[model samples]
Target chain A: MRDGKDDAAPRARRRFLKLAGLGTAASGAALLAGSGAAKAAAPAATEAAKGYRVTDHVRRVYDLARF
Target chain B: MIAPEDQGRAYLYRLLARLLAAAPDAATLGLLRGLGGDGSPVGGDLQGLAGAAATAGPGALEREYHDLFIGVGRGELVPFGSWYLAGFLHEKPLAHLRRDLGTLGLGRTAGTKEPEDHVASLCEAMALLIEGKGDLGAQKAFFERHLEGWAPAFFADLERARAARFYAAVGRLGARLMTLERDGFAFVEGVAA
Candidate 1:
């Protein structure tokens, strides 16, 4: 009575939940670590709100442009 | 790994984009007025921003934005790369930019009427590229292809526009930032050579 298709859904769900839990734990630990984590995330959080990536190309561009 | 200075640079680009995207509301003006500055010319421009915000009479900022960027016919400034590069709006430059945007997996925000080559939009794109984990070579190529062609002249025009008051300060800030970027890029190119 075991179906691989049925098993796959639950397995994926379980894996997703596990990863979510790990992310929450990591953020909780980050909060406990200090203000540095929050400061570091500020720009990223703002960028995420705007809904796009400036990407690593900007860094390379900046590096290339440097005198 | 992202460098902290690069992060700051990206933030500045986004800030400039937003400021140029629309007329600042009272809340936005308040925020600008509260911003502290260093002793640089850019810093002085920020101080000028605060002064302009403080003096923004009712409907003045909106009228200014309209006159400068969105008049009944055409605004004082075109703010589009195509116009600057190919002597017209919606030309080959814009088509090339669209292709580049597609390659970069970027697109205009939904319902936006302006072309992809608007200066504000371009600044936002640059900021997104910097923040989004894109490769350095792509960034350089994009800048050389799109921005390096005409942005500095645009800012200089902005600095002298008769309609410019608050925007003159913005022009100054933009010019300073552009210079810094140009120098930085030139230095890197020199080193590579």
Candidate 2:
């Protein structure tokens, strides 16, 4: 009506395109945020790895078993 | 393919194998201490292991491991499949295990002098198998051929060994896990049949 066209096809196509574009942009933002969170979580995992290691105490036990 | 739920079983077997292999450090001890305890038998054993680690400390655990597994000449227990199956290490059982392991395309880790039949190593192999290297059929075959014959008895012996303290709890956990693995395998076989 605003464009002086009684047929609604062009207006509907415009709305559909706008919605699809918004959906894609929102998903892209979510993907970026997800990757950032994954990166932040990775170092904590490596820190947990440091908790278990071959220490002098373990070596001494290994030495005793040497026969 | 390994169902997603089966991964937990593989992880538990691996954990038990590692705990049995060496004394946990202070950090490792703390992680064990943090596990939630409940009324289940496995939970009780885990709590017992945690308590032992908290009370004894890493130094004491190291000494205990040395005494119980690495005595002057021989430890109080022999953690070997061959011994458990045939009254001696490197016997027919060990040979059979080696053949099966070869068929499975697994081998001992490099630089490790321990025999292939070591209980810890077998558990590790099963963990790998269940983690996707082998399917359910392969898992059942390996367990029946290698583990089911002797590991339960070995765990029972470990639970009763005079030198056991923290390891006794480990023994209990291992015993429970073995039972679960056995039952799981049987259930799968039953479904197939």
Once fitted onto the true fold, the runs of candidate 1 whose alpha carbons sit more than 4 angstroms away are: A1-67, B110-113, B190-193
Q: Give the TM-score of candidate 2.
A: 0.70
TM-score per prediction, in order, is 0.70, 0.70
Model 2 per-residue lDDT tens digits across residues B1-193: 3333354455456566666666776867776665544554445555676676667688888877777766666677767677677765556877778788778777544444456776767876776676556766677778888888889988888888898888887787778767766755544433221
**Pairs with backbone N, CA or C atoms under 3 Å apart (clashes), candidate 2:** none
DockQ for each of the predicted structures, in order?
0.02, 0.02
Could you tell me how far off, in angstroms, the CA of residue B128 lies in candidate 2 after the best superposition? Answer: 0.2
Model 1, span B71-169: residue lDDT tens: 655578767787789866667888889998888777655544456776767776776676663544456567778887898888888889989888887
Write model 1 residue lDDT over A1-67, tens digit each, in one string: 1113354532443344233222222122222111245446534433432333322222322332243
Q: Which stretches of candidate 2 lie over 4 Å from their true place?
A: A1-67, B1-4, B190-193
Count of residue pairs whose backbone atoms collide, per candidate: 23, 0
Chain A TM-score values for every predicted structure, listed in order: 0.24, 0.24
